[model samples]
Target chain A: MTAAPRPAPVAIDDPADPRLAPYTAMRERDLVGRAGRFIVEGEVTLRVMLSARARFGLESVLLAPERLAGLAEALARLPGDVPVYTATKPVMSAITGFPIHRGVLGVGLRGTEAPGAPLPGLPPALAPALVVGLVGLTNHDNVGGLFRNAAAFGADAVLLDAGTCDPLYRKAIRVSAGAALIVPFRQLADADAILAFAARHALEPLALSPGGGETLAALLPPARTLLLLGSEGPGLPPDLMERLRTVRIPMAPEFDSLNVATAGAIALHHLSRSA
Target chain B: MTAAPRPAPVAIDDPADPRLAPYTAMRERDLVGRAGRFIVEGEVTLRVMLSARARFGLESVLLAPERLAGLAEALARLPGDVPVYTATKPVMSAITGFPIHRGVLGVGLRGTEAPGAPLPGLPPALAPALVVGLVGLTNHDNVGGLFRNAAAFGADAVLLDAGTCDPLYRKAIRVSAGAALIVPFRQLADADAILAFAARHALEPLALSPGGGETLAALLPPARTLLLLGSEGPGLPPDLMERLRTVRIPMAPEFDSLNVATAGAIALHHLSRSA
Candidate 1:
């Protein structure tokens, strides 16, 4: 597809092979240090990485021998320069210090940063159709779910406050169904910075709160929308809530609110449909 | 307060005390073997258990001493006969065979089942506003999220095919924000049984598929609606899809579909708003 031949598969039996260093002790290592490199696990996630070669740099790939055949179509799209490593299940498990259930992993460079040029995720640019922002989202799974929704509904980018957890966290990436890699994103300094960026971009910042001026269905979203969602408990800070335009998803009379990610999905879907 | 006292806290020094047996080795035990009993963890979930005492029976509660003050209001609502077990942090961890970070747990009896009574999740009764049915969902977190959305939107009940994971799974209950304890639900034999029950109750069955008859926005749902969601992969079986009305959540071309639970939440919210 890219006029790049499929890379040759290299077999490595030793668990201590230095080529697999980025993947060792995966549970303990964050995998984000050293050139913004990170691990992408599972075949489904790897396919996204393989396809978006311009957005992410392909460092290398490690797969259990049997998985290679299944991944041939995706692997063929890879540039010939990248190395494809293969190992038996036990060796792969020993290297990662966990059971190799998914049997596929890749290392990629986060390529969004172009130094001296304005940052991508926090740019001073024209507004796009949709963007999703997160404030103080500590849970990796929730971060992942939100990204999946943002991408599914065709959000232009995802912005996160420094208080939020890393979207690049391996579990978050896997849980996101790989949307974290495919969808463009940037981390602002804090919640206020997110609002400021939206202001500069002429983007409408809309927060989803349990109590707000209007219902989700009533809002006619503008051309470029910055849909902000907060943590599950102790929601958006009082000061921030006062500053933004707020909307609520009506629920049963005396029930708890929807999970943060689930609410975001409904809101994103509605905005996408309305737009 | 249900004519109940704050249920005096009984200090438990020994981790292996008989009263704490149900919570022992919690990581290994399923906690649903005998008498339909399961463990509810965290202050938020225990509050739901205490509030809906009629739907769930309280066998015993294990708490860390420091958590007692915070739970005073919820504990007061429990029946006077229920024992509130308190242990030091170390003992609590020892009793659970894992770090009891939440420092709160309660054993609840699933009260939906009555002797020879028609199962509540699959009753032959009048149609209600909304119902969610799951087919072949294997993840507990997804199961819990579906229940959370169902309750938030005031769905009448949730029905699970046997292929779906147990909502009573400890993680599911926590993910559900305790909706698993408060919401009415029942497990049926298979996917077909779910469809059959919808038919008998005069509920319109709607399935979510990527390639469906119409977009979600275009659908005019029925008065008594049954929304069905399948696992993330392989979707609802073909025959079931052909037999029922289908709607799709529009996504960007060539992108993967939304997460099953996230998709379900969007559908439930739409149905709730439309109704």
Candidate 2:
């Protein structure tokens, strides 16, 4: 393959520069939510965003001058219109309000073409698919971990209920090892809406519950299956539980429960292996 | 069964009292390492520590008065010599360097009797057992999550290399949801020791690698399998990889990798179910 031409890095020294606004006061803004755009941190995630340009549009990139050389190949792949800003470590830290250890960040616009829709398409091997429907999962770490597991086990997509945390949140994206960027996901109107979507798609909805259901080993998931999971505690609401086929990972007698992410991983592994 | 009589809680009005040394300077001391004693937080872990009395001996209990009534049963079960100290919320926070929102804590000694040894014995159902052997896994969260998954899938034990973080660290204990307290585990002398132990016990050593080995779906673990996991990024050291039967969780193309804990959970779930 021919190498793409290297673009000259645009230097930004002033932390207060208007072009660098997105990099400032990150922690406080992260709390209020990302509004429309989301910050992608670390080199691995930045590369994922670059590769996923068609899905998540790159706004721009801010990196330490030293990292610019290392990311040249990825930077070359970014769209010509996207600007690449380089600054010293101190300048980057001043703008970010913390050390940008990996010294790379990409701001990307959320995918718009398939807004509020499940993945438009999946690879043939990933089909006869397994998908996760998350309800009331407010924890970002769990959300990220679940997406990572979903991607690892060949689950086609993840469907998040309204109460779920933003998959694009920086921490979630980082924790997911950029699976949030790669795995197909969309927010739904509510838990009921997820159930309806599964029904319409002919995807059998299986609710994962701590209370005993069919042992995972005995059950053979259909061609298309939707494994529903709830928040760590309180679990799937009673009303929702009554509506779907419940399945449980038979755990040891007295253990409270596995981490939601770990539980999701086990379930996905089972469904994927069976498929 | 007749109920055992409850032990009266000792009240402490001052956070700085000499008796509260374990509660004070916790964050700093935690960083320095817990000199054989570790903090168990929240109700679930405290209960686990109490039940594991033979493995982890309780040093003391600190609680808010409101929680005392609820824990009467557990307190009655605690050994007669273990002290129970109650303090108001403010005093508890002052002692702990943060809000004791759970209103409870238990200090326990690391089980010394079985140091560097595999779990002595396990129940019949869990016998054809699966155990996790961790190498160079410094992340405490991953350590705790692995223990929790091990417990859920009925794994008999967790064997950690010396490079691994202490499973009894407060964050690990909390993340494990107290599994670190309940699961039998010990720090091995080194990676070589873990491999030797697995061999001596007739435990099949299967190393989990991202570089793609035998697909998990196509492989069945032997009677006593040791699922070996390493730190997420560097993965199992090349030298160690050459020594064990390497296996990989088949993942989607181009995605980074699953979290180490999630990978362990999937592997453990597979071995346990297959058994």
Candidate 3:
């Protein structure tokens, strides 16, 4: 990979400038399809966007000039055509309209792939795969956290259903510490589709349930494993859990609560290494 | 212990009623000491507040009439003089000032115990104890999540330094799924004091860090252990970490991030079992 020329910085004084429109419409971007574009918030995620391993193609960056000196090296990594726009604090606030990400934001293009496209091919020679699957995970924080865990524990990939929120959601990216940008994930129609995808990929499925027949400590990750997690209250569907090998994390009986992400982390750590 | 007679339900139509003062003072109660009282929001926490195991005293309950029928059995457990005030949806919203917890709130008295009082006695004959120690964990969400994990994994108690926030902070309690009330926790002067208390309690101190001398996967839970965790960026003070046995959670190549609460959860799960 070759480094692109550092794009010259441009100054924008008006919040009403059309060039700053993408940075301004964070919430609406989620509602309306982002026209092949996605948003990156905060310096951490911004740096991830500038990294060579980032899946999306960065389109441009909007920054509060104060961050420029600190991000000089990262900014040098921007593609030649990707413009760097600077706005003073007041104008930047008007453009972003929120006190978040500390005046650093990057816009990237998803290319032809939708947020829930087919899985990317695994890194070369990668075997003994371990992955995470999610169903009905609507909460953004949980989704972000799961991705963060997936990255931390070296999961090969993540699989999600339509019921799950997009991991690219800004709040989730922040909560994930930008791991959402690095982890490879695919979204399917729903639980059935996610299971089918796992089966087709030669990964054995394991559903996590509080009523599971086995405890997590007693189970070991299969050669190619896909661990399925559901949102906190109503876990994976009953029949689905019945069909798949199931395991439960032992809890203090009366306090049988664990955040979906926390549960996923413990499971991932247990299965992170080859069994 | 005998049950106190169930308190009579009172109807209050106005938001300005003096009896509703405590409910209206949510934020202020935190800034100014709450005078031996703490608030519990949502039905789950209210139920916990009503539980026989609750450490605090239930002073009164305020509910939207719609929630009354559903909570009847729990109310039967309320003490004799505790008032159950019912307000219409409009009055409820006016009194609460925020649309959270779905119209259910219970005010409980901390009694003579401050939010950070000394530890309660351990259950009789309970041996091989495990606890979580926190330093500079001020984020309510992280603090709440840690408490939730501690409860789920059967952690005997939680110890916090002066830099930490109170677990009873309403937001923290909600995030903990009300486990903040169920689990025993105490606050100390600072990190040094937390270590001092651990020494007094016979809990061998171990700190968690990504740069630790040992990895969690290779470590075993000692008979009695106190696992220490710090906020994300700065982590535990280097000097302190250098002083204690430090362990790390192994991660993928460059993605080294894990949410503090998530980190605490993983460490607690690993050390939860007897070795």
Candidate 4:
């Protein structure tokens, strides 16, 4: 046999190495300033990115030496050649600005495609699909949970309104257990753009509200639907609320609204079942 | 002019003051070693407690002087007389071991009665009701959310399995938006007991599973039902899964599962609609 295949190695002992710039800059919340790429942490999420053939360009995967043992087997399953970087735990922590428990992290380019665009002659079965619009939901975990729900409930796409957090944020990716990598999503400029898209596609916009006009069962329409959800505190903005068909999940008399992500999942499940 | 009836007042500045023991001990997660009474933070949750007529033996309602003004007005609508403590923000923070963002907090007794007992011979129409069972879920937020969903979806009561987290944990109370107080709940010593209770009452045990045997819509019975939910990672224990009637919410092909609380909400909503 030819000499054992050489492992793709890039030793990074210095946390300040210029080659590790992309990884270092992600430590700040203001990651938008450093690069347009999204950070996907943990081995599971990185594995999904490699398998999905998603458009996010891989920069490099960094991990502690021990993590590389497990990652090597996972990498063997992927088709493309990508750079792998290994560092000591201390150096990895210093570069990432935090101790990464998952041992593996990958920096991938953020997809720039606009959400809701026709997928080059989309199939009829995929048409008339259920889509979710997130508004002012800033929590990374909530955003991740929503994506997970959307995927589980058969939502075709997820659209983020201006105020929502980045779905590609590291915490979101980790929280989603990499489901975020498989789901297609894009950010809309504003709520009006979301409504216009819904109107254009003949998708009835159903705003989920605690004080909604009708129970979800009564308000569901037999057409392509868009479920609109708002932030935890100041629910769907008044303007957005006015534009969509309001549907409520009739709750017990005394309880307040469900968590935003939970409400979305419930609505998506109902809508998909009805569809 | 006769002075308006003054609210009960309690003054204590020292963090070690005996009168403020409950409030002080709550700073630690143990909630003063009672492990039952959860701390409810913020004016909103407190307002929920006051309105639900929850049997809260209020040790004290601590608030900053400014925050106290509005709460004073809201408290007027409450049915029982409860002491309202006023303190400086720093003083309150020092006693509670955390910043009181809502500038309000309450020390309330956790309900000890098992939720399974029939509600004092209520009418038949009201008697037959859907209830939620918290099995292995240990997250405080998840427990609170389950209660919130139960209350919202018109569940009769919430039953917590022995392994589940305490619903009265301050975090759970906060996450539930105080729904924890209004929705009646009972903690069981074992899940088997809950299963037996459901069996005796003719309540079918509908276990939620990501890869469940039937859709939630099909699993719901025409009579009283108990929706059983497992924790996030290692879903319903293997033994528990074997015993209950398994059901799943239909999800997108590539997605895994909805968050446990989200799944519960969807199930509750579906069952409520069918009812």
TM-score of chain B of each: 0.92, 0.92, 0.92, 0.88
Candidate 4 TM-score to native: 0.87
Q: Which one wins by DockQ: 1 or 2? A: 1
Q: Candidate 1: list runs displaced more than 4 Å.
A: A1-7, A31-34, A115-128, B1-7, B115-128
Model 4 lDDT at residue A235: 89
DockQ of all candidate complexes:
0.74, 0.70, 0.87, 0.72
Worst 10 residues of 1 chain B by lDDT: B119-128
lDDT of each: 0.83, 0.83, 0.84, 0.75
Point out the worst 10-residue segment of candidate 4 chain A by lDDT: A119-128
In model 1, what lDDT does residue B48 have?
A: 87
User: Candidate 1 lDDT, tens digit per residue, A138-192?
Assistant: 9998999888888788887888999898887888988888888878888888999
Q: What is the C-alpha RMSD of each candidate to the true structure, in Å?
A: 3.1, 3.4, 2.9, 3.8
TM-score of 1: 0.90
Q: Please, what are the lDDT tens digits per residue for candidate 2 over residues A220-259?
A: 8778898999999989999988877898887777674888
Cα lDDT tens digits for candidate 3, A6-71:
757999998899988888856766667577778887888998888987888788898889999999
Candidate 2 docking DockQ:
0.70
Please provide, for model 3 over B1-275, each residue's C-alpha lDDT reduced to its tens digit, 9 standing for 90 to 100: 97766756899998899998888857767666576777888988999888987778787899988899999998888877889999977787788776544778888886565564457744323378888999998799999999999888889889899899989888888899888988888878899998988887788898998888888978977878889999887999999987999999888878888888888888888788662
User: lDDT tens digits, residues B106-127, model 2?
Assistant: 8888746644443654434435
Model 4 Cα lDDT, one tens digit per residue, A188-250: 888888788777766778889887888876654546887888888898888768766788877
As for candidate 3, its clashing pairs are: none
Please provide, for model 1 over B1-275, each residue's C-alpha lDDT reduced to its tens digit, 9 standing for 90 to 100.
Answer: 34644547999998878988888888777644544778899988898888852367789998889999998887887778889999987898998888878888998876555644654444355544688899999989889988888888888788899999888888998988888877778889998888887787888899988867878877776778889999988899999899888999998775757878788877887787766
